[model samples]
Target: MVAYKSKVVERIRLPSRERRAAALEEAGYNAFNLAADDVFVDLLTDSGTGAMSDDQWAALFRGDEAYAGSSSFDQLTSAVADVMGFERLVPTHQGRGAENVLYGALLSEGDVALNNTHFDTTRAHVSNQGAEPVDCPIAGAHDPETDEPFKGNFSLERARAVVDEVGAERVPLVIQTVTNNSTAGQPVSVENTRRVRAFADEIDATFVIDACRFAENAYFVTRREDEFADATVADAAREQLGYADALVMSGKKDGLVNVGGFVATDDGALFERCKQRAILYEGFPTYGGMAGRDVAAMAVGLREAVEESYITDRIEQVRELGAMLEAVGLPVYEPVGGHAVYIDAGATFPDIPADEFPGQALVCELYREGGVRGVELGSFAFPETDRPELVRLAVPRRTYHREHFDHVAETAEAVLEKRHEVAGLEIVSNPAVPELRHFTASLEPVSAERAAAADGGSE
Candidate 1:
């Protein structure tokens, strides 16, 4: 791979440490509530936080601000068809909006929606529709230390069991999240996609893909998968997407855009159904929920996201950060993923009880220590699940350089060095509704004495 020169062209001022701490306290310990200016190194998510290229910015100016049949939408349609191999495009505001429309159209009450693993919003949307969201990920997916090449793959046995128990008729669709976020951002291999596609076909069920990180997933397939070892990233991506009957994308991610998403399919009937919902919930069929400028930016972003050099640089930055953390004796998920490094909070803070949310504690400490923001993928994120607590540091594409990652790693090391001083947090208030409570959950640090007692009592 060839190296490309880049430099930061924009700057923002950060708030004082005292202000940041007070902001965290006022926001109920939720990093999302902190002002953007207070964050020194924001790693909250890769979605919609990436820096667009000059070409994308240039396209934005060319946007035709029409409510119907916009030229910008035409560009997006062409790009989606060229890269994703989909025959129809149904745009939406973002990935979750696409999920809402697609699930609303296909799923009925009590229907089962199976996936390798359902990320937070996907699970919430399925559950909100009175449908069941079943995760069939390989057993290794839950083990942060597991070195499985494709930890995000759906287990064939588990998939079969779900079908047998739920009945084929009750299964609406099977989803495959590329670079499965819920499973440490691990990539689902081409073989796994083929297997799932075949199985879904056998059951006459739709095989849909959550393609938010499809570009990164494709890069992994080319580099890691034997069959695609010699293929280009674009070729690998096209082949991987070919296995899906339909796909939903968050343009904020792999599309390399600031904001946009779409649901694409080849089935005319399904497209019509999804289109109706898109119009009803999002906007007109042409622009969906995005403006013409956003559509134009997405068109250029989709093209750039598949570039070999771009993805190689992006994944390497994440790996560099993971190495930095691991060198400090932090327990990080092995076989570093495409977009982020996941810290095993359970292992790192073994004394911090799960119910108290060790992951949440770690997240807060990172912010307070260095104004660095990250997200927890632990019990708080999935209340009923027994998955190990994890803290994810998601790297935005083209937004930060190596220096920024080094700073974050240093902050993580600082936090780890003082791990014994940290105390877990407890929810003081929760959303009135049970679905997706983590977003608005009000949490406070557990009393220092109680935390000390729990630490002393733990093995």
Candidate 2:
């Protein structure tokens, strides 16, 4: 039971989209110099990209002084290898360039990607590269009970079957850790990691890890599993990383700095292959398109990223907020993972069809009432949303405080109470329909000025 005293209220409600932009600053949310401070607690819409020190930000801006590809990048990439326990680690652009590099050799059309769950970008990258995604999270990885600290779902049998059907050459496997955001903050077990590695060897297929939530996953393993009671966060992380050939990371998630991401591999051949593409977009292997301090900060953050205290505190806070919502009879993701609390809009507002994109409307409601911001999990983050939509309230890397969580929760409860009053919208048409294929329409909130005008000069 998360206690909410009426004494604590939101600093203020950002009623208009334009004015909402000023809420953080107006509410004193911008006092922190670090971006991480802005995200980890804030339900604001940030992709956990980076949280750098003031000095690091200054260094990244001096792009001209940046060594395009420094030995420092190689050192950093090697550090990633050491942390992940892979023989090779490749750094690549997060954009189309990386996909192009993947096409001719590493990936093939009609091939399949088996992961615990999918992120829109990963799915888009894979599908566009000519493969479909297959997520095999441990049964109930998303459920509250019986799931392991590390929910390992890639059974040897499942791995073999996938490889047998797709051909080892075409079937690649991925394991996403921490909050299987798509599956609601489910953690994958380390033992499962060991097993999957064995399975990959058994089937002669490559294994990849989507490590966006790696730090949170490590924290869970240490806390929930008795077997790892003595393990440090870094040890658990290294243990899990050792199981895969390569891993993709979003700098926003684990990297301490902002605006960057990396791909790491253990295979020398694979490293060489991805290197060619890195130059096209991410720059040389040594620099990896990251500025000196950004890399320097990551080197520091990576060390800090595995700190048990930081990881535990961050995840526990999310669960606390989740418990609050669950107490209110609202549908939330069963398990709590780092950085988010998922609202099961479909269950909370069943009258709206899953395909109707109710998440779009709910987003508008939350934003209007409390200025609580979050992204839509339905069509917004996936291919289609409507019948069973999920609204993801992300607490980015560093964004809020204890009061902020309660503030967001209280606002959520208010919206739920009044959800019935919200009018449904009709889609007129989509312009960028191709890209829009996976995009759920932005509910497109009105600007403060526009909304005020519509309200007819009301204060």
Candidate 3:
């Protein structure tokens, strides 16, 4: 890949080790609490963190900031139609906004929504609506050591079980998260999507594909799935999206923009309900919650995201980082998913248990070792639930280069070398944090006295 623009070098502010320790203590050991200026390499998230291309930047001029029926909204709708085979659109501020808008319309109290795997926000939104969000990912999804190409595929068996138990009327939606984020960004196969569609049809539930990383998932389908081995990225994306009754996308991801998301459907009645929710919760149908310029940029980004070259390079860059970590004997999630590299923190630090938050311990150590910021995607992210312990280093799109990843790999190695020294964290207080406690929860290192007492009691 070649650069379309000149490299803009910004100084990476590297704080001293002592300064990092002080910062960690002050922030209560939460990486999200750390200042961006203090981080040398920030891999906390990919959402709204990528650099926009020249075309997207130029589209900003086309924005028409009107209260209704803006030209930018038209551009977005046209792009969605052309790229995703959808007829209607309801724009939102981001992915979660789209989820809230869509779920708020379709779901009622005691309703059930099934997914291959529900990321934190989607699960929280479903819970907020008093609906149950059930995960039905295939067994392969949970095995980080298994190199399955389509680990993101839904478990049809479990899906059937849930449907049977809940009865079809109580089940309103079935979602497939492309490149399932909770399970290491793994790609879902076209065949699996077709099966999911059939199952959704049988139960009369809406089949919604979460299109956050749709392009990346398509690229993987082209490379891995034999049926679509010769298909273009756009064609593969159309095939996958074609099976869905509706789709919810985060423009921050595949859109390649700083902020935007949308829910699209071909069903006119469903579209109207989504629009009502969009207006009630977000904004007007046309502008929704995003700015006009952001709408225009998302239009450009949606098209750009499906380009063969761009999608290829993006997935390969993520693989390159995964390879680097594996070279150092790190327990990386196999097949090196689409958008990020997930480390098996539970395996890395076997001595630490889920309640103590091994993933958070490793996340803290990565920052202290070399100022590299990664997020914990495990028990901490899904507290009060039994989940695997993992650390996700989500690389932003076209933002960091080889050198940055090299530094990240080196930093990970440094932390691994001293893994025994890492200490678990405990929530300072139970004061009502959000359901997604990982975002704003304050934690401190488990005190030696407390640790000893717990160990003695266990013995």
Candidate 4:
């Protein structure tokens, strides 16, 4: 297959090894702490890290700077309605901001919010509101080697059981994270969404979608599901959205924008409530927390993201990288996800214990060896959940080319060759609040030997 032409037009210089080492120590061995100039390949996240297209850059110049009732907001609203099938739109700075507003409005003390799997911020928001976030992912999601097309799907039986246990009144929302971020970026099916919607209706629960990667999920549906084989990517996306009463999106992901998000719904009452909270937490209902320029770019991005050629190219790029790692006998999540490829860190480095943060150890080693930065999605990220320790390589949209991925694959192979030498990390300072410590927790090497192992055994 011929590859898509590379579009990168900018580059930055990487710092020296000494500088990189010092940065790591200062940041407590966290990749998020490393300076952008010190890294070569940064896969820390796809959020707000992608390169904007020529069209998006042009849109930025046409932005309306109005505090309220801007033309740019109108454009964004139309885009959301057309692309996502949502009748009402309330913008936010990002996905989490949308969650804070919507969940803050709907959830009460002791309410249960269920999902296939809650990403870090989603779970945090639910917990912050004194509500329980219950995960009901399909059985196949636990196994890295499983090839389930809809591995991110929530089990209907589990949802029913939860509803029965909690009673319909206590269950406020049932959310489905399309292309589940916590479970290897797996795509959920349209059929599964419909089932979940029906279940939600049965239990008098509100059906919401965490639709950060809705376009990618649509592409997967078109490719894998026979019923949607004849449908265009946009058609499949609309179908998926049709099942949800409301959705929260991080435009940073599928919208192909650097910054923007929204809470969109068809329910007028819920929309009013969410808009009220949006004004309190975010900005006005029209602008939410984003600038008029960001609104313009997101409008364009929403359209571009669902294009057949672009979606296909994006998924193919991720697949190519996954194949490279798997070819070299790396333990990656099977059937590579739409946005990232997950490395089974625990399986690869059996010598490192779970308590020692094996996934984070790999993250540090990758950066030290090749200046490549990735994130650990494991016990470190979700301490209470029984999730496998995984090192995620999230590809920024239109940021890197095939050669860049080739370099990343080679680096992983190099690190794995000496996997036995890799050591674990010990947290030095944790958050006093005890919520999402991986973001700000400070850690140190257990010993000098462990540090040396991460640094590729002395020079």
Q: List TM-scores for all candidates, in order.
A: 0.97, 0.79, 0.97, 0.95
Q: Which order, best to worst by lDDT?
A: 3, 4, 1, 2
- TM-score (C-alpha) between model 2 and the true structure: 0.79
Off by over 4 Å in 3: 2-7, 430-434, 457-459
Supply candidate 4's per-residue lDDT for 309: 83
lDDT per residue for candidate 3 within 369-427, as digits (tens), equals 89999999998888765557889999898888888888888988998888887778898
Per-residue CA lDDT of candidate 4, range 307-335, in tens?
A: 88888889998999999989887899988
TM-score of 4: 0.95
Q: Number of clashing pairs, model 4?
A: 0
TM-score-better candidate, 1 vs 2:
1
Find the 10 residues in a row with the least total lDDT in model 3. 1-10
Worst 10 residues of 2 by lDDT: 28-37
Most lDDT-accurate candidate = 3
Off by over 4 Å in 4: 1-8, 448-459
Better of 2 and 3 by TM-score: 3
Better of 2 and 3 by lDDT: 3
lDDT of 1: 0.89
Q: For model 4, how big is the CA root-mean-square deviation?
A: 3.6
